[model samples]
Target: MGWVACWFIPAILQVVRKHLCLRHDLRGFDGGPSACSRKGCVSLSSCSEAVSMSKVLPAADTLPTVGKKLLKGRRYGLIAHGASITSRGKLILEFLEDAGIEPPQVIFTPEHGLFGEYAYMEPVPSDEKGWRGVPIISLYGSSFESLAPPQRTLSNLDCLVFDLQDIGARYYTYLATMAISMEACARAGVQFVVLDRPNPIGLSDIEGNIPKPYLRSFVSYLDVPNRHGLTAGEVARFFAYKRGLDLDLLVVECAGLVRPMQLPDTSLPFCPPSPNINDFECALLYPGLCLLEGTNLSEGRGTTTPFKVFGAPFIEDPFAFCARLNEFGLEGVAFKPLFFVPKYDKWAGKRCGGVQAVVLDRRKIKPLLVGLCIVWTAMHIYREGFQWRREPYEFEERWLACDLLFGDETIKTLIEMATSPFEVYEYMNAQSKSFVEESRDFFIYPDSV
Candidate 1:
């Protein structure tokens, strides 16, 4: 599925290309938001003259705790990561202890270390020193990286629970891990519960081209809108229901959560899913810009600021004057030219030129499209400076880094064709809409919202 501008405007075409525009059809052409509210279709009389509206959540404290109920009578395995299990709604051993869980039998971790202390792409494994002395199992072992659990690991556990916070981008591997564990639980006859959380990137507002099934990876387990509008619990429920897997799956519904709730208002802590994604801006920028990691040019790796900014020592464009990145006229994001030397990762200690993305509206920012534009733009502008890593990603060689990141080579081909950014956005958004419709059966939320 790709972006289809044709349907979007015919329906909710609000402000004739005005930034911060919201349109309401039932309200006499006034931008009052008759469309999906949770989908970033927020109701606004005008950009200015704001009022304190109702909080876009149901209230976390009011909801019944699922972990407590699940751990009521048995000890089980806990599979989580630092970001997956946050202080906001994190499943701690204390919560289980308070709920009278004898003790967790084990903890399974994804690519990032259990505490999210390790750098990106580092394989985190089982640790005897994990929370409350529970052994941390590494799912990314050389032989175990394929999104499924070994039969041996499931022999002792009766149920498994996953509580992760997702930024809702495709390449973020947390969902992949959840998918793998869900399938394994389905196969092993184990009960799996997914505790729900808000999708930081509102579900209604989506972008990016659908990755063909051939472009599948751990990063993308199911064919979904690139910026999917659902929670981890909802994703799991949809996965089990649509796939016809009759596992004893349960989702702890999040309380008081409304669609399109801004990330800061959710009352949830922002824990970087990985080491370099240290802040919300990084995660917000990731959907579009993460591809730089696979390129020879450093995307600001090994520094205090990673993903939010990028720079490489070669072929100067610190000001982006030569590249004309802003000339592409992308929306919702303001690019301020900057330069910096990375502390460690890709281009350590070299002053590389790049811009710090100032996200004007996280609700409207589509990082995936932004990322693709940059990849295509830099590939042409810098000429000799642009080089695909060519190195294997997640231990696969057949696929290039660009292919893995974008989910298909077709995008790369189009980018190389010098396709306009809007055309690219529409293509991706169209594919994404197709995915949303296809995934309708799996949705647990109201169809309209």
Candidate 2:
């Protein structure tokens, strides 16, 4: 196994070179590192030997059956929002089949859709699936706000089962779906069941500030950390408990899951549920750069590489842009200069100067801070082209898109005012203040990453 786990580039580079042509069977390819930036990547060996292995998931061995937990007769709703074969979610899906539990009348899905087939920003429509063609309600689509279905849609189902794979970012929307769904279940008088999955970003230290209630969009429904250190089951329980919703929620906790472990080894396959986000590396940076969705600069969307490398048609000097980023000495990674044209998203066939994110040290990078620089620099260097996306984002009519993402307008306004990093940090403290206090009750796990 690669000691680097899934967060370091050097370790991955070294391992890749050592086994470059050693054999068809190179060890630790999938296990080496999770995700890294391509901005300042000096590892030449990494670019040359990029071979991906297809991993097959394990068959279920000892999944918990419904008969084991239920009192012979109990109704429940199965929320399978975090659907990925790698995590324990597969076990839960199999459990539904193996656990002698009666068929759930209603099944709810989170962001990324049922099979994660929907593109990012595109809402999934309500659909049906299963061997017998079970109805798959799209919680991400037309009725994404709450879990209430036609009393007829959920009429057959008496209980709710919630299980999905979350990448641990506040604006990711899955958490919001979970919260709103819980509320709906509460109102509909349904029992909710939650099967948990670990936060792939790990339950280490929380980053960034929580979004204020007013800043709350579909992304941040509550005061959870940027990279919330809780599982789906735990977060659901927290909502049910703390929010004091009169919903009956139960969690089927995982026995083998743990914190700090990145994907490709979480016992699952990779699915590009959303566009631009294909792996853990992109996911790691998503919490921050996703804010660019509100900006005119291309966050590398509409191309082979998205989010990892962002540039606009006007960015004439890629080198100088990277220089500004390096001056910040952003931790855990370095920037790599590159130039490319997008076939779709922003530039669309026109050559644009940009750098690919090169993750030098995966464990140490401050994605939010780095993302701040990326956005601020866009405004600084390409002031002419830079503009905030206006109009209702995810339903907020007048609120600025950047504000909802950062969870506050201070960061957005601070950048507008060219605030220094030190000043921004202080501002984040205030935005994050209430989070620390309310989290006292939400800390379901010990302070050990």
Candidate 3:
């Protein structure tokens, strides 16, 4: 029966792949869902026609239905940015005004500020004068202490409403801001409300190791997987449970969203979550490429396609470097050798030998694995030139950037031991599976269709 099933399944999936116009098989030999070639197509069992036709709305859109009841008597502050908009393109503040709901007494902006204009790790200027009349507070400041809302600030508000668009990477910092702010709210006796949005990378592809307890920093506030398969609301629940916080937490669920739906699956417009992440493709690549920040590599920061293209001036052979990466035979992604000059960040104004990582099939690609291979290959081929960044990252100077980004020295050890990428994948995949089992209780959305 097993032998017959294996042969039968492959033949059936091949037919289905052709029928759906899919670029890859509907499922791999391992039976995992492959990337859907059709734009806006969703899930393993569904295509564009099989999934719901309704446009997915951010939880902010449901605010009209639930906000008045929750905020009628409570003084609230909103943690949001420009991307905090409804499906119809109404900004959070504008939606609040239109819905006849009272504006938050104070608005909190994350790392990129309210409009997402600030550069990476740049301190956002706090506006006591407020934007459009509401007092604006910057959560991301120069000091590590400033990453969270002050307890004094929290005390004034009966509730703190969080509505930032998280791109589903641990190092993104917005989720960290949310988790830290939640801790502060718990301390200050404030209710925390999370206006959930879709995990833009989708919920199916959880990867990477959870940072060790000692490696916890602004970038990794909570010990979650790098590609955590949960929404902002789910993370909040997980945080509350893990920390045993005795505080009120409410999650206003998004409409027309499911675990299998990536950002493209939703008809919602892609807003750059941060200044560097300009599109959905950038966000898709961020989980692994973000590790480049801890290295000498230029993560295409100043280029037109940050995260999509990465390189450094030291890499003398672009073609050789790309050839090595492609030889790994990684799935759903391809590396094209190129040269670029960054306008600002790393290797600024210097031509760097690099490669553009093009996503051939989004769903099938393991971005973390792709990123690991890039770094590993570079380290292997350019041993004389490649270097791990030693500068202070996320305000800590104690550990190397790679160690912090990876959550431990284990990855560095693995690379130093000259282990294969598959071995590294085995280690990280084991950790990811453990995280899934532990975090399952906190999941608000169903994992299956």
Candidate 4:
């Protein structure tokens, strides 16, 4: 019976994978069959849009029909935002309604407000009368201390449910909010529940260095790599275990999620988690491109495609810069010379020359490595104009934004010393691997590879 079960399980998973590939006509980022098993799958190009994966559903939708029993006698709160919706287009509040649970006692919002309209790093103000008249507390207020829920606020609730779309990056800030809130929940004796979602960039790709302790701030709140490669629920587990939080933690995991599947592989509709991240490609490029926030360049904010394109007013030769970047022969990516003028933010109203990164093969792309190459090339070429941002970032005024983003001054110091890109790659690769091993203890999902 045991032998039969082992054979049957592998056969079933193979059949399911084949069905998903053929039924959805799922294609890789390069617009081809994602794997050799899917070679016979239909081309998605003929169709105007990719077919939705009916099998994949977020945790909100996977909650049991009689979920009211879980919340019947408990005073609970929700920490969510606009992107917290189910595959059926129902919001978190609506899913709760179907589950027969009453409205949350108090709602908490992250960096963006409930509707996700606020700009990057913009202070989100609390609403006394929020959606359906529940008061909304903003976790991202003016100060670093405001990044966590108050003890008094948690004392009012016995359980807190968290559901947010994470972009698979350490610096995204939502992960930080989840961690801080978990700690606050522990202190106040509140149960922490994470309604899990898929890591949009998938779970197989871990990158960059585990930040040093002193570099910890709102952005680098957890000692994870630049691309932590864990879903929100897994992150919650990691935090609770690492911080030794003595609190009840429950994770309502999503249904039909395979570790290797990226956002494009899912059936759920893309709701831009924030004002700038409008599409899957942007989310895919974000972990690396977001490092631009630490530089003087405009990371395509105030433009149609934020993070997809980057530039600065000082670059006089866009073509040369593109050629130089292409010379590195970075895998799965290409650079095209272009010009843009942001309506707001850095270099607003001034035409700036730069390159638009075209991701040809997402699976092969080492985003953090690509980002380091870009920064290094720019520094070498435009030494006079290039400068690290010294502005107050994420409420840490002492260290420069570049230092904070990279998690230490080592990368900055190396770049300043004109170290070889090969050396930088070796250092980052080693550190990233160490973090991946350390994080394995908390992973909730299985990986294909």
lDDT of each candidate versus the true structure: 0.62, 0.59, 0.79, 0.77
| Candidate 4 segments whose C-alpha is farther than 4 A from its true place | 1-53, 64-66
lDDT of 4 at 60: 70
**Candidate 2 lDDT trough over 10 residues, lowest sum:** 17-26
Error of 4 at 159 (Å): 0.3
Best by lDDT: 3
* TM-score of candidate 2 relative to the true fold: 0.77
Ranking by lDDT: 3, 4, 1, 2
Could you estimate the TM-score for every candidate?
Answer: 0.82, 0.77, 0.87, 0.86
Error of 3 at 430 (Å): 1.3
lDDT of 1 by residue, 388-413 (tens): 87887775678888787777666555
lDDT of 4 by residue, 230-305 (tens): 8888788778778888978887666556668888887668889999999988998888889889999888998998
Residue 240 of candidate 1: its Cα lDDT? Answer: 69
Off by over 4 Å in 2: 1-62, 66-68, 71-76, 86-95, 98-102, 128-131, 143-152, 256-275, 447-449
Clashes of 4: 0
Whole-model alpha-carbon lDDT for candidate 1? 0.62
